[model samples]
Target: MYCYPPHPVRGHPCDNISGNYGTWQANAIQREVVVVGGGAAGLSAARTLIRNGVKNIALLEAQDYLGGRVKTHRQDGILTEDGAEWIHGGSANRLYGLARRMGVLSPRVPDSSYAWSAKTETGRNADPAGYDAAETLYEICERNSVLSQYSDFGYGKCYADKFSGEYRRNRGRRSERAAWLHFLEMWVNKDTGLDDWRDQSARDADHFTDWGLDQWDQWRAGYDALVAHLKKDIPAGTISMSSPVCKIFWDQGDKGQVLVVTQSGVSYLADHALITASVGHLKERQDSLFEPALPRAYRDALAVTELGLADKVQLGWRSSWWGEPHYNLNIIFTNDIQGEKSWLKGIMEFLTIHNQSNMLQAFVPGEYARKMEALPEETVKRHLLSFLADVTGKSIPEPSFFRRTQWQKNVWMRGSYNSYVTVEGGNTIMRSRQPLAQAVEKNGKPVLLWAGEHTHTTRYGTVDGAMDTGEREAYKIIDYMDATFG
Candidate 1:
């Protein structure tokens, strides 16, 4: 998807290039391996392959820039993350470990009661206990014991069946308890990126190994820093940006060569090909992109899995009107029905950007994410500023910087978050992604390999998960080369 520019950065030059190992210019393009996608997984694979002595590599990136969903934009001198915001898990997270090495894993600002305030859409202070009460039910829903029975149904079913009762028992207002529950659902919806949580597989939800709190740490410097780190080991000329793959002929020629065709009409032939495109792109392009068509197993996996949509918006001010520097304004709308084009209702919360007191950011979930993107930038800004004014009773000033992301609308990406097991899929989360992870062999040689967060069983929907998949596939190629070519 995204990658470092083909041209070298001044400090990081691409030199000592080593390649052309395959016969007949490696069947034309002279590549022993062709990596299709330059996101974390693709870049990791390229670096690992080069380190392991397979230097005849060509990495094709669809986007002009690197970091696929890990993009960041400059907002009044602050790095506003458009995709990945936090470093999930603790020391167990590989990215977290990298951050530790980079000396950037340390928290920038402390999170506390002073950091957050809750309010309803009517500009009234929502009861803090209502949120706590919702959180109590949320923790219950997270428990394995709660959703075990609904394994075949959904995590939504468990919440639907029990949340209202929990609300009533916790002394929540009967008239407005439903609104609070909706707020809780929206918060959780951003987790999996589903408008209807009922579509999520309850049984498979717990398959992911919980390292710790999903946001145990974050990159206040911006996630692009990590992308820069991943590409340091790769040779300069190895990456080719503005190269979106069109067709993949995996089992090609007598020697089992793989031919990768890009939209630019350039074809790269290699002994092996590693594809790390997002599942959203794959699901959208699978039928047309793969030659000889994907196998029944992969097709089934793609068909059943869900890659959802999420959007982000950031606003930065030269001066501050908001009281607290780290204020997290949590909005819970009591309105049961959504107004026409009322996508602003989809915003779960707006928090002061970490370490950037002049900035605030918000995330939109599900269909509303797409809807928000369709509106004019000015329209979106007006609604947001008006709402903040109404809630806080302060005249809001124009932001010095304002930006929003359209992850759902990007053709190369198709969605924001990673894939998940669907209740309708009738397979475990692992079972769904496992088939796609397997290499497609020709005459016992790996001709095609898959790597992405979607291909990871336990670590899907994480940056480390994506990098791990890339490393996993790179080793598969390494082992194959050692056994065959060596």
Candidate 2:
């Protein structure tokens, strides 16, 4: 569904409306706060706001459904994920706590060896992994970030320290160096979607604070449950779905009110509006327009920020032949025959399949993730067949069902959340979380605030990080309001 132009009728400036005499009195409604985007960040922000004694908050989401990217679709008793599947950094993740509290099924790592497969140049399986070989491959990947770097962004930057001779004394055979590099390149490409590892700054590489590669937890009942449970505390009708925010007009110069316009041609006026949409969503002019415009510092910070893509393609099998009692999954490599190279490919080369009984899933990230969204179904099926053939000795029958979700193409969420650090093509810590006060000075009082994953300093990109940021921003707003009005 295309959300088109949002024609806002010109009216009294917010400062005039917000004053005891003008716009503030005219447009100033009594809602505690207005939060844009009802995803993890938005929900967490609202919850925090209410807990902090702020009630009558309104949440606006572009999609009819609430859960932004953490949705589940159950078909024929098989559960399929159209958005988020795995929970990274289980220990510190607040979502994990919520999952357990809400009684949702938690995902655990299967304690067994995974299957491996080989494929042809045109993306056809050619080799199968013997029991020990797959284990050995897993060991190699476990010890080295090279595989992750290669799988994620195809930049091979994850292993920059190792590749740059940091581990020269412990290097493997010279003849195999080329092969290993090639394999790593494939991993990086699939993981991050960049052609050159150098395209990313080394500092950006270090930005991922919640790095849990060894173990990943999946939400069995569907990750969306958290979204629903969080929504329950919020009063009905507080959330307005299918409402894409067009522009935000903040009169920080005189009054402290923030006005938000929706694509459906509706206008909302409130004391404050907290933005929690995706970073990529900010790339749009419609998404960024603010009354009196944003400060140059905030503008520069937003301009420098980079958005990464993470996408998923889920396929369902009739039977659970892929799972073994020992290890419930395998990451079969069907490509990477050549040495390190970078480019987006049509074929599903780098794949990690999750064997969760009725459902099997493969993740395609970075640039290829963008390409997969446009690929033909038959071609995609062929690629999966080839991958399965290489990993498992037997050719499991064609999957009874197939479904995929593309974050890059999704309107509400332009791309998946990927973390980044300061040194690499990112804004400084000061710029990231600049308070609304810093954005503007109103009657000697600062106004016009900003928050989201992009505004977070310590933890950014993860759902937990988003929540932490939302809560932090809410308190900042409350503090600002009290300090000013009191």
TM-score of each: 0.91, 0.76
Off by over 4 Å in 2: 1-30, 105-107, 111-179, 185-196, 286-288, 321-355, 390-396, 419-447
Highest lDDT: give the candidate number. Answer: 1
lDDT of the structure predicted as candidate 2: 0.56
- Residue lDDT tens for model 2, 70-92: 67777776676766666776666
- Per-candidate RMSD, Å: 6.8, 7.3
Per-residue lDDT of model 1, residues 73-135, tens digit only? 874467878887787767777878788889777574555634677888767887676677767
Give the local distance difference test score of model 1: 0.77
Worst 10 residues of 1 by lDDT: 8-17
Q: Total backbone clashes of model 1?
A: 2
List the candidate 1 regions with Cα displacement exceeding 4 Å.
Answer: 1-27, 336-341, 427-432
Best by TM-score: 1
